[model samples]
Target: MKLKPVRFIFFCCFPLSVLIFLSAVTKKKPVKEALNEPGDGILLIKNTNGPTLGYSNKSGIKILSIENLYFKDLNKNGKLDKYEDWRLPVDERAKDLSSKLSTQQIAGLMLYSAHQAIPVLTGPFGGGTYNGQPFSAGEALASDVTDQQKDFLLKDNLRHVLLTSVQSPEIAARWNNNMQALVEGQGFGIPANNSSDPRHSTNGGVEYTAGAGGKI
Candidate 1:
């Protein structure tokens, strides 16, 4: 006779669903505002040093935590707030966006941000002339051109040749667009393509066309 022992059966239930709901509620925090008036009394984040792209303020500037910021719909997708919603490192963000944007869009954005002129072409001869000034190592970061290409331009003084022949036609078109913007003064300088000198009132005055197409 074989005797078999009965196995005990048990049902175990966990409150995992409740835990997850509670965790989300606990983690949610409010977005922060970028600027504050004295009456607002928002938490004052200590002034952190930043890149001096513009004229520096003698008095150090204060920052606020992200939690104190205003929430606005950015994408219009109904999502609340975004990393771009705050005033932070837009340059890095632009680079990030560039990775996702079309090449033309990236080029456009580069020109839009360039306060100084950006060269579309530099060559011994062309519609535009090469200044022959070597591209700075750091300046490459602010431009659409690559280090190798910039190096080639400096070595040969044939930047326009490269722009017309080497880079993809699509990119070249965008680069041209940026140049046009600079020439028109929409992207750089006041008077938008006119000379600052009161003596010359002509459009795209001497200064505007000085280095244009790489003239000496």
Candidate 2:
């Protein structure tokens, strides 16, 4: 068995200082362990343009594995394909991002995140100014989004959106605020869905695991 090298670009307002810390504390889980259970699970992932690899069609919707996103072809089909530069070319990859980012401010970050680019507004520990002060990474993202920010994100074209667990509220707030500012500058808006808030929950996306049957 061989391991494929994966190149990922992270975009955030602040420097990726905590990346090492986060990586050290969090072990990357395998795909099977994340989605092997019996139930309907939904998550946004990096989908390349090629044959559907390990994912299968559930009724009409597609259920994807977190591990399969590492390369163009996880199923070993000779043809390698992907939606490269998923973010730079805004029109090509805005729909999916829009689906997950409902609040306009949060959607802004999703657009930049979709392109693997981080905003320039994050702080020392992923803090976005909240309550007139810097908050933790999770706190920044969980704050009540502003309507002014929402109107700016939806104007652009997006493909898919990715949802993850809210480990730190301050980090989340900073990530969201940074995105909102960018989107506002770009003259777009995101339609926020109040019912499902990724900032408050973690059940939307699939988790990874490690093992022989893992999704690697």
Candidate 3:
């Protein structure tokens, strides 16, 4: 059947118009303005449809805004790096980060640090000194980073830290923040991967149950 010219053109354009309308309606909205929260030495960037990014202002890191979303300028190059973009896959991000590291930096990552204790214990095993004085001398706060720790973090580029005895949860949190700020300003801005040995002593009498979570 042959249709009139005007009616045929209208019918052909109607389907295309519907598709365009649907595309416009389904398109994602751009992110809203970041809600900035500045506390202690950290700045938190909150977005409606994006990841929240927290960075230490003292660390010399800056924020990179792309497509109304925020990202940390970890290398401080004033641009978004692949590793710094949270949208990328984990393996892709790891590859991008590994490519940026030098041989020495890779070696440093391989090196696992000795057991460290928060508040710098006086015993020989996990003990550390602040400045030249032991932590027991009351010369420094329990959260203060030891001179030895600073040396390893900066000079040796050590990213892995083994935390042994944390004096208190509060003290441990403060110490972690301090350490993170220290390395966030350095090359590639890699934060410390702090770990601890099994701190919870299990009861011999209790039987293990699958998917039963227990407090530490």
Tell me, by lDDT, which candidate is best: 3
Candidate 3 local accuracy as lDDT? Answer: 0.78
Between candidates 1 and 3, name the one with more favorable lDDT.
3
Q: Write model 2 residue lDDT over 59-120, tens digit each, in one string.
A: 12223333334322222333322332222356544554444344754544545312111111
Model 3 alpha-carbon miss at residue 157, Å: 1.6
In terms of lDDT, model 2 sits at 0.33
Rank by TM-score (best first): 3, 1, 2
Candidate 3 residue pairs in clash (backbone atoms < 3 Å): none
Task: Give the per-residue Cα lDDT of candidate 3 at 157.
Answer: 86
Across 1-216, the per-residue lDDT of candidate 3 in tens digits comes to: 466887989999999999998887766434235646566677777855777877777898877766556788899898888999999999999999999999999999898777777876665666778898888889899889898899889999898997766777778888888899999999999999887555344442222221112121
After TM-score superposition, the amount by which residue 112's alpha carbon in candidate 3 deviates from its true location, in angstroms, is 1.5
Runs in model 1 lying further than 4 Å from the true structure: 1-21, 32-96, 112-216
Q: How many backbone clashes does candidate 1 have?
A: 14
Who is ahead in TM-score, 1 or 2? 1
> What TM-score would every model get versus the actual structure?
0.23, 0.21, 0.74
